[model samples]
Target: MTMNDLQELFVHKLAQQYYVERELVEALDEMARHTTNDRMSQGFADHREETRTQVQRLEEVFAALDRPAEARNSSVLEGLEEDRRELESRIEDDELLNMVYLNAGMMTERVEMTAYEGLTTLGEQLELGNDVQTPLESNYEEEKSAFRELETLATAKDLKSLWEQLTPS
Candidate 1:
C-alpha cells in the first residue's frame, strides 16, 4: 500500500502498536521476575496478561479493517526493553532495581498512551467510524489507567528518593 493518506497512516500506526504490545508482553514478564517487591512484581504480571488481551483487541481491530493482523517492528519499544535489561543488570541494590523497573514501566505506558491517542484521532479523520475508534479508545483508556498506576508506584518513597538523587540540582 502507498503511504499516501490518513487511512494508510492509521493502519501503519496500528501495526506498530501491535508490535509494541507484543513486545511489552515479554518485557513485562521479565520485569515481574526481576522486581524485588511482591506487589510490584504482581503488578507487572497482571499488566502482562492485560497486554495479551490488548494484542487480541488489536487483532480484532485489524479484522474490522479487513486487513491481516501484521506487525511492524517498533524500535522505540525495542530500545526501551534493551535499556531496561541493561539497567537491571547494572543495578546491584534491590530497592534501586525495583525503582528502575517502576520507572521503566511508567515510561512504556506513557509511550503507549500517546500512540493510542494518536491512533484514535487518526481513525476519526479517516472516517473509519465507531467500529474502528471503539477498540482504540478502549486500549487508550487501559493505557491511561496503567500509566496512573505506574505513576503511583513510582511515587513510592524508594523510587521518589532515587529519582530525586538522580536529578541534577
Candidate 2:
C-alpha cells in the first residue's frame, strides 16, 4: 500500500496501538506483581486481560480493513515503560510507590484514550464505518474507565499511613 493520505496514516496509527497493547500486557503483569495494594494489583491484572481482548479487537479491525494484523514499533510505549522502571527504582515507600504507580497508570491510560479517540475519528473520516470505529470507541471507553479507577486509588486516604510508617526517622 502506497503511503499517501489520512487513511494510510490511520492504519499505521492502529498498528502502533496494536504494539502498545501487547507491550502493556507484559508491563501490567509486572506491575501487578510489584504493587503492594491488593486492589491496585488486581486492577493491573484485570486490565492485562482486558488488554489482550483489546489486541484481538485490533486484529479484527485490521481484518475488516483487508490488512494484516500487524504491529509497528511503539516508541511512546517504550518511553513510558522506561520511565515507570525508573520511578519504581527510586521510590522506596510502598504506599508512595503504589500512589506513583496509579499515577503512572493514569498517564498511560490518557495516552491510550487519546490514541483511540483519534483513531475513531480517523475511521469516521475515512468512511471505514462502524466496524472499525466501534472497537476503537470501545477501547477508548475502557481506557477512560481505567483512568477513573486509577484516580480513585491515587486519592484514597487509607494508604497514607503506609507512607508514614515507612518514613525515615
Candidate 3:
C-alpha cells in the first residue's frame, strides 16, 4: 500500500494493531508459563483470552471497513519482544523474572492503550460509526483495566520486597 491518504494510513495502523494483539495472545501464554508467581501467571493467562477477543474485534473492524483482515508487521512489538527475551536470558531468579514480566506487561499494555487511543481517534475522523468505535473503545477500556491490574501487582508488597532484595546495597 502507498502512503496515499488518511484512510490508507488508518488501515495500516489498524493492521499493525491486529498483529500486535495476535502476537500478544501467544506472548501472554508464554509469560504465564514462565512466571512462578500465581497471581501474575493467572493475570497473563486471563489477558491472553482477552487478547484473543481483541483480535476478533479487529477482524470485525476490517469487515466494517470492507477490507480484508490483514496483519502488518509491527516493529515496535518485535523490539519489545526482543527486549523481553534478552532480559529473560540475563535473569535467573524467579522473583526477579516475575518483576521483569510485570514491567514488560505494563509496557505492552501502555503500547496497546496508545494504539487503541489513536485508532479510535482516527476512526472518528473517518466517520466509521459505532460498529467500529464500539469494539475499539471496549478493547481500549480492557487494556486500561489490565494495565491497572499489572501496575497494582508491580507495586504489591511482595514485589517490593523482591526488588529490595535484588538490588545491591
Candidate 4:
C-alpha cells in the first residue's frame, strides 16, 4: 500500500497492533509456563486472557472502520519475542528468570501503551466515532493497568530478594 493519507497510516498502525496482540496471547502462555513463581505465572496467565479481549477489541475497531480485520507484521514485537526466547534458554536460575520475565513484561507493556497512544491520537484527529474510539481506549487502559500490576510485582518482596541475590555486598 502507498503512503497517501492519515487514514491509511491509522489502519496500518492498527493492523500492526492487532498482530502484536495476537502474538502476545501465545507469548504470555509460554511465559506463564516457564515462570517458576506461582504468583508471576498466574499473572501471565491472567494477562493472556486480557490480551485475548484486546484482540477482539481491535477487531471491533476494524469492523467499525468498515475495513477487513488484517494484520501487518510487527518487527519490533518479533525481535522482542526472539530475545525473550534466547534469554529463557540461557537463564537457569528461577529467581533471575522471574526477574527477566518481569522486565520483559514491563517493556512489552510500554510498547503496547505507545502504540495505543498513537492510535488514540490519530483516531481523535480523524474524528472517528465511538465504536472505534471506545475499544482503542479500553485496550489502552488495560495495557496501562497490566503494566502497573507488573511494576508492583517488580517491587514486591520476592523480587527484592532476587535483587539482593544479584547484588553482592
> By summed lDDT, which 10 consecutive residues of candidate 4 come out lowest?
158-167
Per-residue lDDT of 1-169 in model 1, one digit per residue for the tens? 5698788898999999999999889989988998888878998999999999999999999999999999999888989888988987898988888888888999999999999989988988888877788888888888888888887877877667877887799
For model 4, the superposed segments whose C-alpha errors exceed 4 Å read: none
List TM-score per model, in order.
0.91, 0.90, 0.97, 0.97
The lDDT-based order of candidates, best leading, equals 3, 4, 1, 2
In the range 1-169, model 3's lDDT, one tens digit per residue, is: 4698889989999999999999999999999999999999999999999999999999999999999999999999999999999999999988888988998999999999999999999999989999999999999999999999998897888887888998899
**Model 3: residues >4 Å from true position, as ranges?**
none
Per-candidate alpha-carbon RMSD to the true structure: 2.2, 2.6, 0.9, 0.9
The number of residue pairs in model 1 that clash at the backbone is 0
As for lDDT, the candidate ahead, 1 or 4, is 4
Per-residue CA lDDT of model 2 for 1-169, tens digit only, reads: 5789998899899999999998899999998999889999999999999999999999989999999998998888888888988988998977778877787798899999999988988888889988898888888888898889887776666655565665687
- Local distance difference test, per candidate? 0.89, 0.88, 0.95, 0.94
Candidate 1 lDDT at 35 equals 87
What's the count of clashing pairs in each model shown? 0, 0, 0, 0
| Range of the 10 consecutive residues with the lowest summed lDDT in candidate 2 | 158-167
Task: Look at candidate 4 and give me any clashing residue pairs.
Answer: none
Candidate 4 residue 143 Cα shift, in angstroms, is: 0.4
**What does candidate 4 score on TM?**
0.97
